[model samples]
Target chain A: MKKILIGIIVVLLLAGCSGGEQVQSKPQDQGYVFNYNGIPIVVNTDVEPVLKELGEPLDYFEAESCAFQGLDKTYYYSGFELTTYPKDNTDYISSVYFMDDSVSTAEGIYIGSSVDDVLEAYGEDYTGGENAYIYTKGDSSLIIITENDEVISITYQALVEGLN
Target chain B: MKKILINITCIVLAVLFLAFLQKLFMPKYMSSIYEGNLIEEYYDSDKDHDVIFIGDCEVFSNVSPIVLWEKYGITSYIRGSAQQLVWQSYYLFEETLKYEKPDVVVFNVLAMKYNEPQKEAYNRLTLDGMKLSKSKIDAIRASMLEEESLITYLFPILRYHSRWSELTWEDFRYLFNKRKVSHNGYLMRSDTKPVTVVPEGRKLPDYSFGENAWYYLDKMTKLARENGIELMLIKSPSIYPYWYEEWDEQIAQYAKENDLLYVNFLPLADQMNIDYSKDTYDGGLHMNLAGAEKFTAYLGKILKENYNLEDRRGDTKLAAVWQDKVEFYEWMKQDQAMEMEKYGYLKSYGAAAQAIIN
Candidate 1:
C-alpha cells in the first residue's frame, strides 16, 4: 500500500511541471516594441527612454562625427539604428531604423509591402517624389521608399526640435 | 674569427625572423576582412594609374578600373576602404600623390558625411597597410579612436599580437608576399543580392556637413588645386544610405563655390540603366560586377569628353600590363561564380554565414 501511494504522488508532480510550460509560451518576436525609458520609443518621445530601455549604447559618435552619416549622434545598439539630438539640454530620438524585418509598426508597415499597401495602411496623408514616400501624421512621420513597386525601407522620425 | 662569424650570423637570422613575423602578423585580408587588404595592395601595383580614387567602399566596390582601362584606356585605381573618413581620404590622397601624379583625382562624396574619426577597426583597415611615412603618421593621428594608440599603429605587431593563436594557413603561405587582391583597387563581387527594399532617408535635425569635414574638403580641394590636378566629386548610386536633398544642396553649393564638378548619381539611376533589383550585390549598399561595369562605362565617357583624358590602349607597354590584369579579372569572376554556386554564399572568398543571413 505504501509503494503504490508513492508512485501516485510522483506521477502527479510530473504532470504539474509540464502544465506550467504550456501557459508560459509566448511569441518569438514581441513586435520590436523597444522602450528607451518609459516613453515606448514611439514618435515624439525623448532620448531618455532609449537609455532607459537599452541603457548606454556600446559606442557613440558625436554630432561632428555623425554629420558625415547625416545624423547628429549615431548610437550603436544590438541590431538597431538609433539617432538622437540635443537641444535645450534635452536629448530625444530624431530617427529610428532597422535593417531587419522582424520589427514592425502598429499599423503593419514593414520591409516588403507595396507602394499601394503603404497608402492604404497609413491613409493618403503622404507626400513623395519619384523615389520616396513621406507619410506625415502631426509631428511624427514614417518615411518609406519603394523601388520597383516594393517597399525597400521604412523609418520613423519625430519632426520636432530636440528641445523647445 | 669564430666569435665574429657567429655574431654576424645571429644578426642576419634575427632580421629574417622578424621580417617573417611581420608578414605573418599583418592582416591577410585574403580569406576574410577583404577591406583590410585593399590599401596594402596599392604597394604591389605598378603605380602607373592615370586617375586615383580615394574614398570609402562606395568608390572601391562601385567603380572598375580594368573596365575603365579596357573601354576608356584610362588607367585608374581606387584607394578605398570601409567607412573611410574625410581626413582619411585627405591623408590617403597625400600618400597617393607621393607615388604617381595622376592627372585626375576622384573623391567619392559619401565620405563627406563623416567629419570626425570613425571606428578603430575601420581606421586600421585604411591606415595600417600604408607604408610608414609622414602621411601615415598624420592619418594615424587624425583617425585613431580614443582607445587606440600611435605605438600600435607604428608597430602593428603589438596591435595584432593577440591574433597569434588564431593564425591560419593563409598566414604561413603569404609570409613573403600577398595575392593580387584587387584589379586596380576594385574588390569584385560577381554575385547579386538585389535591392528588395529601397530605404528612405530620414530628415536630419541638421543637414549641413560638419565644419571639420568641410575643413578636409577645403584641404583636399586646395591640395588638388595646388597640384594642378582636376578633382571630380561623385556620388555613387548605392540607394540604401539614402542621399538627402539637404546634403545634396550643401555639396552642390560647395562644388559651385570651388568651381569643381559634382555628379549626384542617385538621380541619374535611370540614365545609367542601373536596375537596383539586379545590379546591387548587397541590397544597394554596393554594386555587383554588372552594375560596376555599367557605371564605369558611363563615367568613362564623361571622363573622356569632359576631363580630356587620354585613351592609352595603343601603348604596347600599357597594353601588356593591362592584358595580365584582364586575365586575373576573368579568373576571379569565374572563381567567385563557382564559389557562389557551390557554397550558396562566398565561402571560398571568406563570406561569413552572416553575410547572406543579414
Candidate 2:
C-alpha cells in the first residue's frame, strides 16, 4: 500500500516537471500577436518570426527585409558589440523617414515588448534596408520599399517550399 | 521468471540509455543545441570540393553554392555560420578538410572585422567533428563547451527548448500557415525601397601596401598553400559607397602583392546597372535577392572563363548526387525571369567580378 502511494506521488512530480518542457512556441505560434489592417497576424511564431511575418507586408516596406538583415546576419546582434569585439565606432539610426506613416489600424496587444523589441524583433531589417532591400532565403522572397517612414508595398515570389 | 524479467529490464535500459546518449552527442537535426548542424547537413560533400566559401552572413545570405555547381560545374560549398569571424573560418576549414579536400578556398575579408574567435564558436567547431560517446563526462563537457550543441546534435530539446508552460491556440497556426517556397538558396529583397544617402568624402580605411588586415590575409594564403590549395580573396558587392575607394584599394593591394586574383566590381555599380536605389536590401552594405542574382552571375562567369572550370552537371556521377543543384539553377533562372517580368525593370549586367591574379 505504501509503495503504491509513493508511485502515485512520483508520477505527479514527473508531470509537474514536464510542464516547463511544453512551453516552446514557434514564431507563427504566438510571441507577438497583432491585427494589422484587419489581418490576424503573429510574428516569430512559425520559425524565428522575421519581419516578413506581417503577411505579404500589405503595402508595408522596410529597408532590410532580406534574410540576412539584422540579428540573422549582422555584427550588431552577434554579442560582438557588447560581449565579444567592440567596434571602433558605432552609429544607430535615431529615426526612419517612411513616405507613408498611415497606421493601418495596428491592433493587438504586443505584450511584454518595448520599442527596442520592435526594433530588434522586426524593425532592424526594415530600417537597415531603407534605401533598397532584398529579402531571400532558399526560394522564399520579399521585396520592400519605404519612402518616408511608412512601408510602401511588399511583393513576394509565391514559389514556396514543402507545402504537402 | 523473476530473473528473466530483471535481465530484460537491464538490457532495455541499456539500449535506451545508449540511444539517448547518441542523440545527445551527435544530433542530426537543427535546434537550439546544434546551431550549425543545419548548415553542415545541407552542405555535406563526401569528397573534397573545387571551392569552399567561408565567412559571415554575407557568404550564406549572398552566395549560393547550388548556383555555383550548376553554372561552373564546380562542386563548391559555402559553409557559413551566423556571425562567423576569421578565426572560426580557420577552424571550420580545418575540420571540413576531414571530409572534403577542396582545391580552392575563398575567404570573405569582411569577417576579418572579428578580432578573435569566441568560446561558443570554438566549441561548435570542435563538437561538430566528434562522434557520440557513452561517457557522461564527455556529454557534460560538450554541453558545457557549446550549449547549442547539446540542443542541436545531442539532445533535441535544446533547439526547441523554449520557456512556455503550454502552447496556446496560436501554436496551431504554424500548421495551417503557408510555408514559403524553398528555392535553390537566396532571400529576396522586399519591393519597399528606401532612399539612401552616402556620406561624401568619408575617410575610408586604408588597405595600403601593408597593414594589420594584410597580416591575416598572408596567414590565410600561407595556410591554403601549405595544404596545396589555391586561395582567392573576394569582396562581395554591398550598397555602401565606401566599398568603392577604401575597400577596393585594400583588396587591390592584397591581390597585387600576392599576385592573387582580385575582383572589385564596386565602381561598375552604374555600368553593371544595379538598381542600388532598389536592389540593395540593407542600406547598400549587401545585395538583396535581385542583387545576388546579378552578382552571382558575374562570379560564375569569372570561375568558368578564368579558372578553366568545367561544368560537370552532365557528368553521370556528379549529376546523380548534385541533381538538386542542377534543378535549382534552372529554377533560379526561371525565378529571375519571373521577377524581371513581374517587376518590369531589369538592370544591365555589370563587369563580371572575376580574377586570376597568379
Candidate 3:
C-alpha cells in the first residue's frame, strides 16, 4: 500500500514537470521584420510601409554631393539615413544607410558594435577591407562599414556582381 | 641628317603605335554592352538632323530614329547614354549645336532627376565619344567625379590600358572604322519582357528639380533659343520609373514660366496603344521596337502638327541615307530575333534588360 502511495506521488510530480515544459516550449521573440515586396528592406530597400514601420526620422532633407548624383533625398534618424530616389523626397526609397549605435539591428549589431560582434552575429563568411565588413547571404547583404574596428555605419544593398 | 630623320620616324611610329593601342583598348561593344558605343557614334553621323534628342537611355531606347525617318521624314539623332545627367545634356546640347542645330531639340526631363555626376563608367560612355573641343573640356569639368582624372578623358589609353588582355577580333576589325551601332542613335532590340505589374510611385516630400538641374535646364533653354531651336521637354512613355503627378506639375509649371512645351507621355501611354506587357521589352522600364514604333508614330504626329517639322523623305540625300538606315533597322530586328531563337536570349543589344525591376 505504501508503495502504491509513493507511485501516485511520483506520477503527480511527473505531471507537474510536464506542465512546466509547456511554458518553455512557447514561441520565441522574433527579429525585426524589415521587408517590402518579399525582398528584405535590408540596406538598399527602396519602398514604402517599411519606412512607416521605421517610424519618423529625426531629420530629412536633400544631401549635397559631387559624387553621389542619384537618390538625392535622405531621412536622418538616430542611427541611419534612409535615402530616396530623386531629391523630391516622394518616391521608392533607394538606400537605407545606418549611422550610429543608437539603432540596433534585430541581431543586435549596431553602429558602435565591434568587429567581433559582427562575426558573431553574421558568421565568419564575409569579405571587405579592414575598414568594411560585408556579410552577404544570397542577394541580401548586411554591409558593416567600420572605423577603428568598430562599426561606423551599416548599409544593405544588393551585392550584385559586376554592378560595381 | 641621318639622326634627325631617324628621330622623326621614331616620333611618327610612336604616334601610330599609341593610336593603334588606343583603338584596340577602346570598348568594341560589338559583342556585349553595346550601349558603350552610343555617344561616340554621334560623330560618325552626317550631322544633318531635323530633330536632335538629348537625354538618357529613356530617349535612346524609347525613341526610334528609323521610325521617325520612315513615318515622318524626321532626321533625328539622340546623343544619349545610360543614366545621363542634366549637365551632361547641356554640354552635349552645346557640342551638338556646334555640329547641327536641329529645328527641335527634345530633352527628356528624366535626366534632370540627377543633379550631379552619377558614375565614372557612365561619364566615360557619354563624354569619351566626343572630338576634343572646348565643349568636351567643359563637360569633363562639369561631369567628372572627384576620383576621375581629366587626363583619362584626353588620353583614353589610361582608362582602357587595363583592357589589353580583353582585346578580341572585333577590337582589331573596328579599329579604324566602327560599324554603326545605332540607327542614327537608335539602339534596336525586338524582344519583349511585359510589365506584369506597374510600379506605383511613392509619396515624396518635395517635387522640385534640384538647383543644379534647374541651372542646366535654364542654360539649355537659353542655348536653344540663341541657336534658333525650339527646346521640347518630354517624359517618354517608360511604364516604370513612375513619373509622379507632382513632378509633372512642377515641370508643367516650369514650362508655363519659361514658355516651353512639356509633354508627359505616361497618361497618353494607353491612347498611344502602349500596353506595357506587349509593348515593353524589359517589362515597363523601356519599350521594345514595337512599343518604340507605336510611341514614335504618335510622336511623329505631334512633331508634324505642333513643331511644323518638314518631311525630308523627298530630299534625295536624306532619303538615300534613311533608306540604308531602314534596311539596317530591318536587318537588326531580324538579327535580334534570330539571336533570341538561337541562344534563347539576346546577347547583343545591351543584353536588353533581362529584368530590371527599377
Candidate 4:
C-alpha cells in the first residue's frame, strides 16, 4: 500500500512538472504541408533535403543573421519563396511565401480568393483583424492578408520558440 | 529556547547558501555576448545626458554616444539590448526618467514589428542586469513568455539552475565584480563585413502593426510629453529585414499626428556618407565603428540645430568626465584593431570568442 502511494505521489509530481513543457510542433504533425513536385516541404525541418528534391532555385540570397552568428538564406522559386534560419550550422525552413496567384495552398486558397472563400476553405478557426487572418495548427501558422475582401498575400510560417 | 535558536541559525545559513548559488549560476556576460551587460553598465554612469537613445540592437550597434560627445559635445547614452520588444523599451524608458531626464529621447522603430515576447535569452539580455524596481517588475510581467514565471525572474537561480553544469571560469571570476562591456551603452566592433547583396523585404500577410505594439508606443509618447521631453522616432539604416513602404507610411502618419520628428535613415544613407561597403560590420545589418562615427556626426549637427542643444564640452567638469570616456573609447578601438590585425577576426567580441571559450 505504501509503495502504491509513493508511486501515485511520483506520478503527480511528474504531471505537475509537465505543465511547463512547450508544444513544439513537428513537421510530421497534422499541420499544413506544402507539396512541390511530389516532394513535401515542411517548415521547421532541414532545408537541404527539400532543396535537393526541389532542384535549384531561380535566385538565392544569404546574410549574416541579426544578433547571432549564422546566415539567414532565402531561395526564390517560380511561384513561391523559401526562407531558412541557421541553427547549429544547419539551415531550417522558417517560412514559405507565395509570390503570385499561380500557386494555391493545399486547401485551394490563393491570392485573389475572396474572404468568404477562405472562411469556407479553412473554416472559422482563425484569429486576426479584417486585414489579416491567421490559421494556426500546432506551431505552424497559415497567414492570409486581404484587401477589399480579396486575398492579397499568403504565407506559411513556422512559429519558432526563440528569436527568429 | 536553545533548540529554536539553532534551527533559526540553520535556516539563515541555508538561505545565504542558495543566494550565493544563484549569483554563481547566472551568466556573468564578461567575455562574449557583451550586449547582455549593457543595461547594468548604465547604472554606473554619471546619468547626465542631453539625449537618450532607446531600442534594440539597432540603436546599440549603430549609434555611438562616444562620437556624439567627442564631435558635437552632445552627451548621450543608449539603453539598448538584443531583440528588445516595444513594451520592454517602454518600461526601460520609464525607469530612465527616474534617474535623469534628457532633453530628447530617440526610439528606433525596428522593434515595433514584434508584438509579442520573443526568446527567453533575449529577455534576460534586456532585463537581468536591471536593478530591482517597480519598472523592472513591470517589464518582467510585460515581457514573460508562456514558459516564464515571475518567481523565476525574481530569483533567477530558479531559471538558471540548470546552468550548474555549464559554469565556466569567467562565471566564477565575475560572480562578485562584472567587467564593463559598453561605452555609454554603445558596443563597438571595428571589423567590417560590408554589404554584398541587399535583399528585398518579403511580402507580409499584414502590414499594420499589432495593437499591443501601438499601445506601448502611445504610452511612450505620452510619457515623454508628461516628462517635458521631445520624442523623436527613427528607422535606423538596416538594409535587411526590409522596412516596407507600408510600415513607413504608418510611422510617418503617427509622427505627423503626434507632431514628433520621424527620420528614415535608409534613404539618407548616401547623404550621411554611410558607405555600406566600408561602413557595416556584419554585412548591412549594423554599422561598424567607422560607420557609426559618420552617422553620429551627421545626427549631432541636426540635433543641435533642431533642438537648440547647447554644446556641454565648455563645462570643465563635464569635459573631464568625457575625457576619460574618450580615452577608453580610443583604447578599445585600438585593442579591436590589433585583434583584427593579428587573428583576422575579433577574438574578444561576438560568437567567435564564445566558441573559443567553450
lDDT of 3 by residue, B80-190 (tens): 877778988989999988888799999999877666775665676678788899989999999876656677678776566655676778888888887788887777878
- TM-scores for every predicted model: 0.69, 0.50, 0.70, 0.89
How would you encode candidate 4's per-residue C-alpha lDDT over B149-253 as one tens digit per residue? 777678776666656779999988999988788899998988988887665666666678989999999999999999999999999887866888999999999
DockQ of every predicted complex: 0.02, 0.04, 0.02, 0.25
Native contact recovery (fnat) for each candidate is 0.00, 0.04, 0.01, 0.22
Q: Ignoring the other chain, what TM-score does chain B have in each prediction?
A: 0.93, 0.62, 0.93, 0.96
Q: Could you tell me the fnat of model 2?
A: 0.04
Better of 1 and 2 by lDDT: 1
Candidate 2: Cα lDDT at B235: 67
Residue pairs with backbone atoms closer than 3 Å in model 3 (clashes): A43-A156, A44-A156, A46-A93, A79-A99, A89-B204, A89-B205, A90-B203, A90-B204, B193-B281, B193-B283
lDDT of each: 0.73, 0.44, 0.71, 0.82
Model 3's DockQ score? 0.02
Q: Which is the leading candidate under lDDT?
A: 4
Which residue pairs clash in candidate 1?
A36-A49, A36-A50, A36-A53, A37-A49, A47-A92, A68-B113, A68-B114, A152-B197, A152-B198
Off by over 4 Å in 2: A1-164, B1-38, B43-48, B117-195, B198-219, B240-248, B328-358
Model 2 has an lDDT value of 0.44
Tens-digit lDDT track of model 4 for A9-120: 3443344232223322224454678886678887878999999988889887776655234777889888899988766667888888988988888888989999999999
Error of 4 at B230 (Å): 1.8
**What are the per-model C-alpha RMSD values against the true structure?**
16.6, 15.5, 20.9, 4.6
Model 3 regions more than 4 Å off:
A1-164, B203-205, B350-358
Candidate 2 chain B least-lDDT 10 residues: B349-358
At residue B195, candidate 3 shows an lDDT of 72
Model 3 CAPRI rating: incorrect
